[model samples]
Target chain A: MKLPAKAAQPNSENLPFFEGAEKGDLVLPRCDDCDFVIWFPREICPECGSQKVSWFKASGKGSIYSSTVTRRIPGGWSKVTPFVLAYVELDEGPRVMTNIVECDPEHVSIGDRVEAVFEEATNRDGESGPPLLRFRVTES
Target chain B: MSIKGKAFIAGVYEHPERHLPDRTLPQIHADVALGALADAGLSTSDVDAYYSAGDAPGFGVLSMVDYLGLNCHYVNDTETGGSSYLVHAQHAAAAIAAGHIDVALITLAGKPRTGGDAPGGSGRAGGAPEAPFESQWGMSVPGGYALAAQRHMYEFGTTSEQLAEVKVAASTHAQHNPHAFLQDVVTVDEVLESPMISDPLHRLDCCVITDGGGAMVIVSESVANRLTRHAIPILGTGSFVKSSQSGRIDLSHTGAVRSGPLAFAEAGVTPNDIDYVSVYDSFTITVLITLEDLGFCERGTGGQFVASGALRAPHGELPFNTDGGGLCNNHPANRGGMTKVIEAVRQLRNEAHTEVQVPDCELAVAHGTGGSLATRSASSTMVLGRSL
Candidate 1:
């Protein structure tokens, strides 16, 4: 099946809780009561349980915590199995799970270093979805 | 006066006749109920309450009593997703503690969701309101997780070899389980050499398709006294939902991060205290993430943990997946969650045999994930400390 379309909007306006990935920007929720970074980006901190929070971007960098290879593949996507999915510990102190492109899958391992690079996948006609964020190996 | 004392799981069972293709959802429920009652040595006449979780109607004992030839005073159809039934069990225990029912029969079954398009999927749930980011382009759960796998490779230098190692081990263990669907040990070479489905998550790394039904009977310590002699106590349990397909965040730490800790705190135990574990392996990566999330190892260290020779058979500390996980076993839709519970009970009951069986184990944990990672998910952990 096709991926969910909710993630394709470009404008993050008036939206309940979402923002597209921008260059050099790591978007997260900030507490209105007492500004604290919240990765899950909520109206309130799951911690203090506040209702007011805003989004801000930060540096995207982290180490690979763990990963898995999906061979059974997902729905309507048999051709895309045998892939590597991982959880990256962002240096900003928040971990973001994303795709690792442009590298040999065999070279990936836990604790290996990485840097976030935004790549836009266009579905032809110069029309594109949201800015897709991927990670690349970091120069140790 | 400790609240953490053992609680009895009065009855538990699967479908009686094994494969029943023509069986209706309600029919399966009746058979499962029969088996669980038999195990508990209590008839429907003894049941004070019944619980069900599914996208169906006429649940409760009303739809089932005809099969039981008896009636119940209490009934419930609380749907919490596939993981909901286990959640139902915890709720039943709470009700028992509160004197709501003498014996609560908690059962979960789905009408065999025939394959088609994934939910809220197939081009997105735009409501004229697609989430926007993934809709414009194609990004399913597989694609979302693909991003995570790739990031892991880029950051921690995780290799495909490490992932293949997990799949291989799961397959090896599954070989011993008669219920497993896919046999044949999958080699690391076969996994790596396979085509790239989503860059990092290959075809083998994904879960499978199959149909299954499971039911459980939980009773108050008082009701259980009159039920059966054999009882598996529920030492402790916990449940939580982190994100529900809401937004993108860490793909690693699940709701389990909170739920797992809660169960441990309630059980007065830790990961090391676990004797056997039936971790939900929806995909090979899930186990790796769970290892780190559940505190089995430090973050980013799960790859090394699996690669650790100490976990190898005949020497390893924890022997997981005695029945083969979703990766190797039958992942019949909602069955993915119940399998963990079933295995935990089986192992605790001295039922596991062949390859992955632990000699004589007590104290086990089974965990399952329901719902998507981007949004909300229910992660439930049950600590079964044998009291027999």
Candidate 2:
């Protein structure tokens, strides 16, 4: 994340990463042992324990688990609460907690399916970077 | 890992001013300490050891040992971040079981609630700079969760409405708790309308902040028996660390997946055997993850399991978070562990009041998490039941 491509800054700072609506590619640090893709990419491969880790792509389709819609956004990040907070199980294996965006924020139902669509935009960090990965409710 | 008798939580106290008179971490801690001890009708001198999370101005074990003018056999100040105090309780029980110390006191107090973080207090308390990749990528505490929450949504059919159920249930408990800070009867619509702090996470999805402190005391089976006719002994405790997140584990499963079995084996019980639960709900995800991880539901099915109405009662199912929890209750960040454990203690001791409580509750379990899901987060669970 050090001097990352900006979108990758959050990937580096390792906390409070703000991204726009377009960075939807499920890219993360990779495995040196097999170069297999890893979610929440980090130093080593959970498979081979290889220290040589790099970014890799993820399958963006999965089912919606549970989600919460919040009304307040503290720390000046308001304007989106009472919004949906979701836990989606990726087709790849990890269950990610995130927001489901694009369509009617409602009409999002349990078991209603989704697919990742990247919306490219700059984050508040001033990095007109990678398209944020946002989920749109697709098929059941 | 095993308790001979029920270790009832006899003392529970909070000091909002431990950050200063009006402000001093030690004083804040003392208020909670004294309150808990007084509630239990015990004296400071009767306390044998101390346990806590985070660092204060002092540099020694039981930093306030002399300041509080008390001394004992063992003490724990392992700043394992949020779950530190829970770990301290487990460690204290272990120590007491091993004949190390008795009448142990575990407490927590910090300045973060006052809108000011102490120097070098980044959960690591200025420990070694975090691993380079995490720091280099600029990933943050909530982001890791966002990443996981996003993944969970991707895999399961969970929805915002279900997550709202958690906060709603917790707020219901908070409404009952006179001490809880955020007790608004927010609606699912309201929660949905809240601003997005992170995508998928509304501001309400996060825990609230308040300046406060807390303390708990544990003692040996013998001392506990003499002091009180009834005690809620710690039956079994477990701490599991996957160490590094290579690839074998999924974000949806917790160390509890491993620890729950180990703890059950140690305690000689099953999930159905338990009556109530005090889950650590750092966010909606933590609860979702643990629900599946703790075997409350099968993997990949947690989303359905939670929203199923099985969690609600007369259905007579086990109640969870009974005290509003970190989500709708005490979320002092560092004291998150203490709050869950204390609530479990109160329920087991049959002490929680109306607005939220169990009738003649007996058994309960508490879980705590320290690091973000992206890293080596420590997961600890303690199974508590009343001593007959």
Candidate 3:
């Protein structure tokens, strides 16, 4: 299945998360003070207002909290028709927006077990971009 | 210190044409501004405060205020997606109550239909914190809401037919509205038969993309009393933004769960006291979920509440979206907040179409949900009562 072009530009706050993706690792930030795992990695902890956030490798295991099979794709992603977009609840207690891949789009269900799979994105110019972190259903 | 009865909705105007490719964005803004001022028996000179959202073109409030030639002292460009206008209404009323501004004008306009950009299209600024994590997935507007609908169905046993009932009721009201984009009444089967844009949400479940706009004139109590038009009292207003909670997301509820109670508490009324409602119907699931969040029914019972025809106008226990709502009516500029308030004003003024007009409608609620239902979203609720 075709994936959307990597449109995210790495910044100072989120650069670590991208750097981890380059090594095929699902890295997440956790607040040392509050013990809150921050999704969409940021510099400060939203819970405790602490800049003392630490990065660690996550288990890469999660369950589908909710999902939708998008039949109508928009703009440049029209080529990626019939893709399953979902929110996966991580085993470490954070939810991440991701695509459920390597399975029939229609067969994906809420609460299904999934694991992180980093796929390299390529633009029309055949230029490679950052590895996109997607999820695939794990065998029961 | 409450804004209750301190300010009133003096005038409201919804642009007639759903498609206006020939008109520029500023022209539509001017049209609605003048239309509302005219309806209030006021002029541009009387407008001292101007309000707008992100839909305002160019420099936002600065450009619209100068283009409209309004000599204003108070200006607000607070944007919360589609719910921005409702938040503006609340802010305008507060300003009026505080004696900062007597007359406030709020306008919204967009050409998304002609421009071919759906609301919430990939318009996020580069380097937005969420973009790195969420943008990679092909998440469309419908896709986000479909996730919520799927979870709701899994947890509450909500059926597609029950969700389709929302579209049926909207189409029923649209048939009475001559200017409605889709005036032909439809059935549950038709809604089901429509192609699924996203799983659990059919094409019929989505709102129309219109190029027109709308405006409202809110005034202080003294200004409202001096006007000839029937002024609808602004009883209470509440707003809240619900986000992913740093990844601990719950799809079962919306920000309405908080905003509804806050508004109801300030209005000194319960949900039972509301005579009419205009909940934003960006999707059928939106109406169903909002009804529960707004206390119209118990949680997990919205399916049965809506399927029982409670939203049908003229006779339902609680008539809603008498203007066909965004489901069948015009979702101008991809923002339904302005139209939601306009229809509530229409209902209170007894100016609604004879077929869908709620008899002796006194108190009404106009609520809007902006942004996506499954992701970060804003909910604004306003309570209105007929002037004494």
Candidate 4:
């Protein structure tokens, strides 16, 4: 029914993406030399091997490339059983792993249009961390 | 020069005990190593090269080599998750072909069943680039493969029943393996009736976790000639790493697309020439996608190919995983590649159980997939031929 409570532990390379999520925006790194949009946020462009990468606010809109309804949650998270996990192919041409929320888990299908939504989560130390990016089905 | 025919798998051994709480990790490694050495009619003193992966205990290759008292001139601890052993075999073959070393010893051991949590149970720690992006979500091992299965069904009309056929065939073959973790034959309906762990992948589609390990002894031409046991020649070997390509990932295929063709080309053999195959069956969907990638059938026809009982041992068009594979046999240390190579060696030697052994099997392929299919993964494939 909900994403796990674990928070993203941001580092120097990905700190910008997590900072953007805190501001309710989906930001991604793009290769300045080759125009490649890097996913999982890295320092160098995997395509051109260029270190000239910059961050920009994305459209936050995408379609589901693939999805799965997880009935058995590991790490003793069975209370939130049957949640939808998916890879959304953003309009900017990068796919991200996120949760599909705000709809029945069974209703989520491949190619369904979705929009990014951020949800706040608390870390193990009881500190509120950066919001996690999830997706919800939207009208085409 | 190619590694084809330069090295032979002179000996192989798979630990019979699925659960060994009394044994230590290094002990298990030593057990399989000695088992394989004895099979090859060689002593520990004959080993000059050592290969292992992340599953190796303590300091990896150094720990195992010293613990086993192996005086090696060359060593490799290449880590490709479950496919590490296959990759090791490929590397060993290349090393032998290059005349860098002879008598390479490869071993794998893990006690996931008696040792508690499977490897990588905890999320990646501290500054793993992908950890921040994907680890927070509920991405279980099955969930990753389910994503691929979901997309495959969406694009290719593959059904749950078709996927069940893989499990059915594995269970059927597993019935003949006394060391198999699950020996009961299952049906399509039974697999479908099993609880869904992740969508499109039922509990039955997953491999069994066990506490065991396996070992292999690959040697040079001269070493093989000196050994009394039947030597299965390593004809061709290829390994490739497939990543998400910075989010341009295609869930429909695997790294086998590159590795398989490379191996076949080097071996000068086609898929039709393979008398048996040992595919890493981490899950049923894994087999379906891999078969397609390996060019066994058209890309989307794997559903029909497998559902037709092509993977069943003894009488199928291409008997596969005659030792039950990771699906029903054993996934030692939560890694299945070691056993994949072990079984292929058995088939090439005509040493597999009579009920599941392929008759006059002369050629076989042993393939392994490491990491998750939906994310970054590694594929290793080897073509083996019966010794003349």
Candidate number achieving the greatest lDDT relative to the actual structure:
3
C-alpha lDDT values of all predictions: 0.63, 0.64, 0.90, 0.90
| Model 3 C-alpha lDDT per residue in residues B238-348, reported as the tens digit of each score | 999998787788999999999999899999999999999999899999999999999999999999999999999999989999999999999998889999999999999
lDDT of 2 by residue, B1-388 (tens): 3553434455676553322425666767677788778766688999888776654446545467877877777776776556777778778877787777768877777666564452224333332323322332224355456556765776876677777666766776677766677767677677778766554666666676656767777777667667753456787777777543443335556677877776666777787777777777777777877877887778777667766655442133667876677777676634477778877887777777654567767677888877666456777888888763
Cα lDDT, model 2, residue A120: 48
Please estimate how well model 4 matches the true structure, expressed as its whole-model Cα lDDT.
0.90
**10 residues in a row with least lDDT, candidate 2 chain A:** A1-10
| lDDT (Cα, tens digit) per residue for candidate 4, span B237-293 | 888999987788999999999999999989999998999999989999999999999
TM-score of each: 0.73, 0.74, 0.98, 0.98
The CAPRI classification for model 2 reads as incorrect
Give the range of the ten consecutive residues with the poorest summed lDDT in model 3 chain B: B121-130
**Ten-residue region with minimum lDDT total, candidate 2 chain B:** B129-138
Docking class of 4: high
Better of 2 and 3 by DockQ: 3
Q: Put down candidate 1 lDDT per residue, A1-140, tens digits, no spaces.
A: 12222233444342333343634355666778776666544455655678788776666777776554545544443454444455566676655555555566566766778887666545445565445566776742
Off by over 4 Å in 3: A123-126, B121-125
Judge the docking of candidate 1 as incorrect, acceptable, medium or high. incorrect
Using TM-score as the measure, name the better of candidate 1 and candidate 4.
Answer: 4
lDDT of 1 by residue, B249-313 (tens): 55546788888888888888899888787777766677777777777777787788776632333
